[model samples]
Target: MTDYDIIIVGAGPAGLCAAIETGKEAKVLVLDRKQEIGCPKRCAEGLSLRWFKKMNLKPKKEWAVQEIKGAELYTPNGKSIKMKAKKAEGYVLERKIFEKELAIEAVKKGAKILMKNQVIGAEKKDNEIELIVEENKEKKKITCKIVIACDGVDSLTAKMLGLNTKLDLKETDSGYQYEMTGITGYDENLLHLFFGTDIAPRGYIWIFPKRKGTANVGIGIGAYEKETAKYYLDKWIKTQDGLKNGSIIEVNAGVIPVGGFLEKMQADNLLVAGDAGHMVDPIHGGGIGIAMEGGRLAGKHAIKAIKENKFSEKDLSEYTKEWYKLSGNDLKRRLKGRHLLEKLTNDDFNYLVDSINVEEALRIGNGTLTKKDKTILFTKKLITRPKLLKLMIEYARD
Candidate 1:
């Protein structure tokens, strides 16, 4: 048995961040099932630089796949609008390099890294958690004072521990993306989004450029009872311009929990970070920042629990509290917006595209909402129609 003060499963951003923080205060062991670190990337790799600036972290040269100035949004009717940010907009990260750097940072801080180790299950007894990890046809046990489950969306650890991981179909977004070369259209380093039922059906399509000639183009659909992301992606690709002439470099499928943050995200001597805790922004489907933030909080709280010699569920709730304190209201507001999106018809969205043009022209003259730079844009139906807003208010209030 290998003993550690804290054991983190998964080597992605959340897991690596947790390992980094925990290793500073205690002996930490980090494990990943994958043989190579950060190979076979799963994300669209877009991240806001604003979040990194606030954390006082600088992106290395390898981290930048491209620098972005802003984003352009397209409604279902083919209407488009572009928004440039006042500050540096974001980065399209090289996830392979980004993930590897996190592991390197953890190793620099004295955490042990185990590659190709699959944690099949864990046992909890006497206030300690014993993890069963498999590597190369051999099984091993790792005992630790606390377990941080930073596994991605479909986490076995959370399921095995009896945490509520069930997602309402309406609350889940099924997504598929392709990495491609020879992509056309100008590389503004701008992320492009296409929204409407016919296009994405309660979800949306995105194109995030990583280089001059390469991009990650993907689509997501609301989790309907019988539909899968592949089905939606296939249908959507046929309608995209850049992808029509491009060849697929790689493909990825993943689920995002966009309904809202988990009502509960902690258990006895354990904490869930990232998608396992449903920390993604409901509106944008961007999660790395929130996931890293959750990982940081989980690491700090785990250190506190170890120092206090208490690993009760109650003690672990501190991470939950801090996560909510940091991200709760934002997620809630976005969830409200997301729910409104689910109810919108394609025609409604089209009407909205025309309405926004009117509103933008009017705002330019008076400079009211346009002056403030509409952070959240409600469609014409949501604004002109009181009934829809009332419905959204009711849903949000619940």
Candidate 2:
């Protein structure tokens, strides 16, 4: 019984960013099932300085709780490589506040946000899409010229609109985390990453400090693993003398789509972004920045569609093409690198860590590293180790 120029599902970073971009030029309404903007966050809340500059975000002391100076990577044998640099610096945020800030920007741009309103059903015609929203105890249908789906991993809006966003088990990773206070025995300034098949399988364990005594301790592992992510996390925490006594204030678990980037993100009057589109970093599984970027692009294109009065799939597909050129290709390359990393044995991990010097590690942490034809060639170590080099070459086959 209502109408809008654009309707956005979910009020996460992606949806809010989309609203910010489209609200200025069109009548945009955003709906979320939550009572508040950000509550019970599902992420580790770490963001790099590069992203802050890229998104033109000013870090507020209220939400940017802790600044990370660098990272310390650990191998299976316990060998550690510390990477520190200006570009490697970032922050661990109070995500609940950060997301709320994004929402404020969206509202300031003239977007109307309806919290606790869930999109229960959707229907699309040749031009406009109608959404059935459930608020309180009543259902109301709202029609819009376009619908942007930013609902997380279990998104139903896109599927209802006929966009398949299902992810295979191999493409997804199981993440489990605990926000612990009274944590100690680690640098509050550097991110800690532990990697090993026995430790986390194809993923890694992270400790991102939010304060001097509090941190988000988490792990990501193969979704198909017989042992759950919590099992590994709990097992590892018990071994950590300092973390063993920390009090957990919150527990978060979810499925992260690390691969399987969708080539098509749009239908006639529908576009998908964020985790719903599998737009996550394959290696690190970070999605907040990427999701916001994707959302911004979606909003930008939605403006074009509304201005030109064109809503066809082809017309809206400029977003998809632009996304690929902007980030898709780089993410694809990282995915390949992730696949190669997954094949490395624990010994290979130890050897690689041993081979990497502090400077080389810093380059990687600062985002100054990429592979040429020798994808696994980080140090000149691969050239000296024929067996490892051959294994990498064999797996590098696309």
* Leading candidate by lDDT: 2
lDDT (Cα, tens digit) per residue for candidate 2, span 194-239: 9999989999999999989899999999988889999999999999
CA lDDT, every prediction? Answer: 0.78, 0.87
- Per-residue CA lDDT of candidate 1, range 114-226, in tens? 99999898888788898889999899888998888888876788767667766666678888999888878855568888887766777888888888878888877777735
The all-Cα superposition gives candidate 2 an RMSD in Å to the true structure of: 2.5
- Stretches of candidate 2 off by over 4 Å are 86-88, 358-380, 383-387, 394-398
Q: Where is model 1 more than 4 Å wrong at Cα?
A: 225-227, 357-398
The TM-score values for the models, in the order shown, are 0.89, 0.94
Sequence-dependent TM-score of model 1: 0.89
Q: Model 1, 120: alpha-carbon shift in Å?
A: 1.4
Q: Judge candidate 2 at residue 366 and give its lDDT.
A: 34
